[model samples]
Target: MASASLKAPPLPFLRAIAWLRDGMYALHRRMVPGHIALLELATAGYLSQATCAAAELGIADALAEGPRQPADLAAAVGANEDALRRLMRLLISAGVFAQRRDGAYELTGMSQALCSDAPVTLRDLLLFFGADLHRKHWTHLSGSVRSGGSLWPELEGMEFFEFADKHPEAGEIFDRAMTSVSSLSNEPLQAAFDFGRFGSIVDVGGGRGSLLVDILQRHPSMRGTVFDLPRVREGLEEELRMPGLTGRLTFEPGSFFDSVPKGADAYLLKHILHDWSDEDAERILRTIRAAMESEARLLIIEMVMPQHHRPHPGKIIDLEMLIQTPGGRERTQTEFGNLLSRSGFVLTGVTATAAPDCVIEAHPAW
Candidate 1:
C-alpha cells in the first residue's frame, strides 16, 4: 500500500512549478536553432522507445544491487553488451540512469521508480503504455482525428474492452497497468475526500477492487462492494483474503450499463466515465441513478479537464481516449454538469485530490 502522505502538492505550488518548467522549455527553444528544437521534438519517440527497452530488459532491476558495467548488465538482462551500453548512454542523458566515472551504470531517481520493488513502481504502467497494442493504436491517431471518432473498433473489428477480453495476456497487462496507475492516486484520493461518511459504498466498474480495498482499509466499519464484469471477479478472491477486508469487502459482478447494486450510501466510479462517450456515459449514470436512493451520492473519480487548458495531464490522456475508445473523453466541469443533468442528477460539488483525478459528487434530481 502507498503511504498516506503521497498526496499532490497544492495547486498554487504546482502552477508555479509548471510555469518554471515551461519557462525553461521556452528558453531552450529560444537558445536553440529552429531546426534543432524541431528535431528534438521529433526525436522524442526514440527516447520513449529507449525507456521502454530499458524497462523491458529489467535494466533498473539489474542495477538494484549497485552500479554494474554494461557487460555485466547485458549478461544479467540478456542483451548485447554494446547495444545495452548505447541504450544506457541515451537514458543517462535523459536523466533516467547515471554513468559513474568508473564506467558503470546505476539507477537515477527516474530509473529507480522503474524498478519492480520500488515503493511505487511504474514498471507495469510503462510496459502497458509501450506495449504493441497501444503503439499500434497510436499510429491510427490521424485517422481517428479525421473521422472525429475512435479508430480502435474499426481497425480491430472489436471494441477495446472486447479485444482485451479476447486476449488474456493483453488483458492482464492492462489490468496491472490500471492497478499500478491507481496506486498513485488512491492515497491522495483518500486524504482529499471523506469516504467515512458513507457506511455502504459500491465501486461501480471497479476492476479487482483495489480502490474499494483502500477505502475499506481506512474506514473499518464501512462495507463495500466491487461491481464489475463477471471476468473481473477472477482474482477477487485474493483481494477478499486481505487482512481487514474479509467481511467488509465483497465482489458483485455486473455491468454499469445495465445496473449497479441498489441502496448504497455512495456509488464510486473511479476512472470509469472517461472511457466512454456522453451517450454511453449517460446510460451508465442513468443506470446507477435507477439503482440509487434519493440520498445516495454519485462519486465520479476522473480527470476533470481544465476549461481554459493551460497544462494538464488530462489533455494528453484525452488524445489517448480519442485514438483508443469509441467517443470516450475527459470532460470539463461544465461538461460534467451537463452530463449529470442529462442523466437525471444534479452536480453537487467537485473536490480536487492530490492526484489529477477529481471527485465529482452528484445527487439524484428528483
Candidate 2:
C-alpha cells in the first residue's frame, strides 16, 4: 500500500538523476580530452566512408549553386531520398553540411572542398582510396603488421603497381591523386628550399612534372627535367605548355631503379625513397650515386619521422606505407644519414619545408 503510493518516485527526482548523468558525461568529456579524441579516432573509418560516398555522388558539386532538399539531391544523384537524407545527417554532424530549419541541406566550407572544381581538390584522393581495390587493403592492416609487411599483394594476388598497371582506369585515378597531392606540396617546397644555386635540376620520379615546373618557374635561369616512367611523361603535355615551362623544362622517360638523367647539378627525389625497404632504398641511392658527379647534390624531399611522441602527420603516413608497400617506411634523420653513408653519399643537411616534408640534402661521398 505504502509502496503503491510512491508516486512514480517523484518526477523531479527522476529529472535530477537525468541531469546528474548528463553532467557526469559532460565532465568526462571536458576532463579527458584524449579519451574523447580516441573515441572520435575510432570512428574515423566511418567518417572517411561517408566522405567517399559524398565525393563519389558529387554531392558538393550538386549543392555548389545553392541549398537543396534531400529529395532534390537524391533525384539529382539518382539515389534513394531517405537513404541520402540519412547520409547527409551523418555528414552534417561531421561538419560537412548544415541542415536548414526547413529540412534542406547546404554545403559548409568543408563540404565545398569536396567539389571537383575546387582549386585544391581532394576529390580524386577520396574517390581513389574509396574504390574497392584501395579500400580493401585497410581491412588486412593488422595482418600486415603481424607479417612485417603489406598484405595488399597477398590479398590482390599482385603488387599495387602491377594492379594499377593492369587497370588503366585505376592508374588514371592514381595519377590524378598524385598530381593533386603534389600540387599542394609544390608551393611549400618552392618556398622552403632555394633552387637558385643549381644550374640544372632533375625531378626524379616526378609525377606530372608539377614540382619541377613550379621550381623552374621560380628560378627562370635554371634548366629542369622531369624524369619518370614513360607513362608519366605521356601525361605531361599540358604541364609542358604552361607559360614558364614551355622551352625550359624537358622530359626524360626511364626508371630510377635502373638510371636517372645525368649532368643535373641537383637531383630531386620528392616522396620517393619512403616507398622502398632499406635494401631497395640503398639500391636506388647507389644508382643515383653512380649517375651523379662528385660535386652533384641529391635533394631527397620526404617526411622526416619525428623523435618525440607527438601528433605528427609523418607517423600516420608511415603506417599507410606499411600497409601499402612491403618495405616502405618513413625514416628518421639518423636513418637517412646512415642510408646515405651506405650508398656512397654524405647527408649534408635536412631543412624543414613549409609542408610536412623536409629537404634532405646529400652529396656524393666518392
Candidate 3:
C-alpha cells in the first residue's frame, strides 16, 4: 500500500496579492534609475535655490560673456567673496558652473536656464516653488494626509490665494510659477486641438492667460475671453496688455462658481476642476453647462489617472493635490464620464496634447 501523500491547492487571494506585489516591485526596480536622478537633483536644492538667487542677483548674467573671480562677482552682487566662492563650489558640483584654473567661475548649460535673461527662465518658477512658499507649506503635507484638507491655510494662517494676495512677493512668485506651467501646456494643446473652428473661446479660471494667448496666437481666427477671480484677472490683464495679445484676448473678472460668460463656441477650462471636490466640481461644471452656447463643446485639460493597475505619473501628482487642495485628485476616463454626465455634458473623447496632460472633450446635452 502507498503511504498517504498531501497536496495543496492554490489560493486565489494569495495569488492576486503576489501578482500585485511583483508588479509594484518590478515598477519600482525599473524606476530606480530615474528615481536616483530625481533624488540627486532634488537633494541639491541648495545649489538650485542659490542658482535662483544668483539669477535674481545677475550672477549668471554677469558671467555670460566670460568667467569671473569670486571677489569680482561677490562685489557685484554685494556679498562676501569667500561665501560666494563656497556657493559657487556647490553649484559647480551640480554642473551649473565650471571652475577655472584661476579660481573664476563660468556658466554651464543648466546655469543658462537659471539666468533671468534666458528666453525661458525657470528662475521665477524655481525661486517660487523651491523656497518659502514650498518650504513652509509643503511641511503640512502630513497634516493634509491626516485630514484630507489644504495645508496652505494651516501653515500660512490664511488660504493659499488669500495669503498670496496679501503678500505681493508671494503673489508674483505664485503667478510666475503658474505662468511657467501654463506655458508648457500651451503649445502642445494648440497643436492637439483646432481652435479655428471656434469663434470665441472662454478660458475659465485662466491664470495669467498664457495658454489663452498661445492658443489665440496660434489660431489667428479665434478670439478669446478669460474668466477668473479679480486677482487672477489682474494677472491676465497684465499679460494681455503686453502689446501683441491686446486685441486678440479679452478679460472678464468673475468667478467660475458664479457664471462663465456665455456666447462662446467652446468653453475651455484647463487645470481647473481638479482643485475642487466632486460636489464643488459638479457645481462649477453645471454653471458652465448652463452658460454654454448652443453647439458649444467643453474641453477640460487635466491629468488622467489610469483605471487599472497600470502605472502613471498622475499617482504622484495626485498626492500633490492631496497636500495642496481641499478635495482633489486625478481620476480615470470612466470617472470623468460620470462627472461630465452629472454636469449635463457627455464626454465625446479625449485629445492627447503635445504636453503630458490630456484634453477631455465633451458636448452639452441637447
Candidate 4:
C-alpha cells in the first residue's frame, strides 16, 4: 500500500494507462496455469476415470486399427454405447481424441500412446499413474510438501515397494511403466551416444531388459547384461530369446546397494540415482567402485538441473521426487561431479543428448 504522500497523482491520460496495465495483469492472472490448473484439476478426474475404463476395457488397443463409432467400439470392448460416446466426447474436447464430422471418434497421437498394443506405447504408465489410489495419494501432496517424506506409505500404510510386492497386478504395472518409459528415451539416447568403444556393458537396475535389448541391437558386437532384482530375470531371459540379441546378453540378479558385478568396460545406470538421496547415491556408487575393474567407466543417464533456472521441467520432477521418494531431484553437473569425487570416482566428461537428458561419465578416482 503506497501512502497518499508517496503515490503519484495521475493525469487523465495516465489513468487510462493504469487501467490498461491493470487489465493486462488481470488477463494474465486468468490465463496462467493456476487458473488453468483449477480447470485441469476438475478435468483430471474425468481423464483418470476415463483412462481406468479404457485400460479395463481395452478400448485404446481395440481402436488402434482405425477410427470407430461409439457403438462399434463399445461392442468390441463390451461397454455401453451411450456411456462410451459420452466419455469419448469429453476426451475429444480435451484433445485426447478426435471426432470426424461423420460421428466417428478416433485416437489422436497422444491417445495412441495410451494403447497397450502399440509398438512403443506408454499405456502402462497411463494406466498405473492414473489408478484411483495413485491420484488420491497425490491429492495429499501437501503432506509431502510439509514433511519432505515418502507419500506411498502414508497413502497406503505400506512402503511403495512393499505395496507393489503384495499386489502382483500393481507390481506388474509398475514394471511395465518403467519399461515403457524407455519408449520416450530410446531413439534420442541410443542415437546420441556411441557404444562402439565398450565391448561389454552392465545396466544397473535395468528393469525387464527392454533398454538393454535395444542397446545390444544397436551395437551387435557388444555384449550386455541387465542387473536387477531376481524377479526381473524372467523378463530378461525372455528378452534374450529375441531374434538378434540372444547370445550376447545375460541377466544378473543383485541389489545395487551391495557390490555390482564389476568386469564390464562400462556401467550404465539410467534414471537410477534420482530416486535416492545423496547418501544413498554415494553408497551405490561406492559399491560400483569396489566391484568395477580399474579400467571400467561409469555412465549416469539422467536429467541435469540447469544453472539459474528460469523454468525447467526437471525442477518440477525434482519436486515430485521430493514428495514421492526419499531423494530430492536431478542435479547440476557440479553436484554430480561432487558426488563422484566423494564416492571415489573422477568425472571424465559430460555429453548432452538430443533429448532433454545427458550422459555423465566417470571412472575410479586416482
- Best-performing candidate as measured by lDDT: 1
Q: What is the TM-score of each candidate against the true structure?
A: 0.94, 0.85, 0.79, 0.85
| Candidate 3 runs further than 4 Å off | 1-58, 64-67, 99-104, 242-244, 306-313
Rank by TM-score (best first) = 1, 2, 4, 3
Top TM-score hit: 1
- The regions of model 1 sitting more than 4 angstroms off are 1-7
- Residues 194-227, candidate 4, lDDT per residue (tens digit)? 7668999999998876666777876889999889
Residue 228 of model 1 has an lDDT of 87
Model 3, range 1-366, lDDT digits (tens) per residue?
Answer: 011121222335434665698798677757779878678667765655677667667777788878888888888778878888887888788788898998888888787766665544567677776676676656677888788788776676776667777888787787777766665555556656776788889999887777777667666677898887777765655667755567878888888888889889889888788877888899999999989876999989998886656555577678767866768778888889999998899899997654557889999988
lDDT of candidates 1 onward, in order: 0.87, 0.82, 0.75, 0.77
Which residue ranges in model 4 land beyond 4 Å of their true spot?
Answer: 1-56, 308-311
**What's the CA error at residue 315 for candidate 1, in Å?**
1.4
lDDT tens digits, residue span 207-236, model 1: 877678888887889999999888888767
Candidate numbers sorted by lDDT from highest down: 1, 2, 4, 3
TM-score of model number 4: 0.85
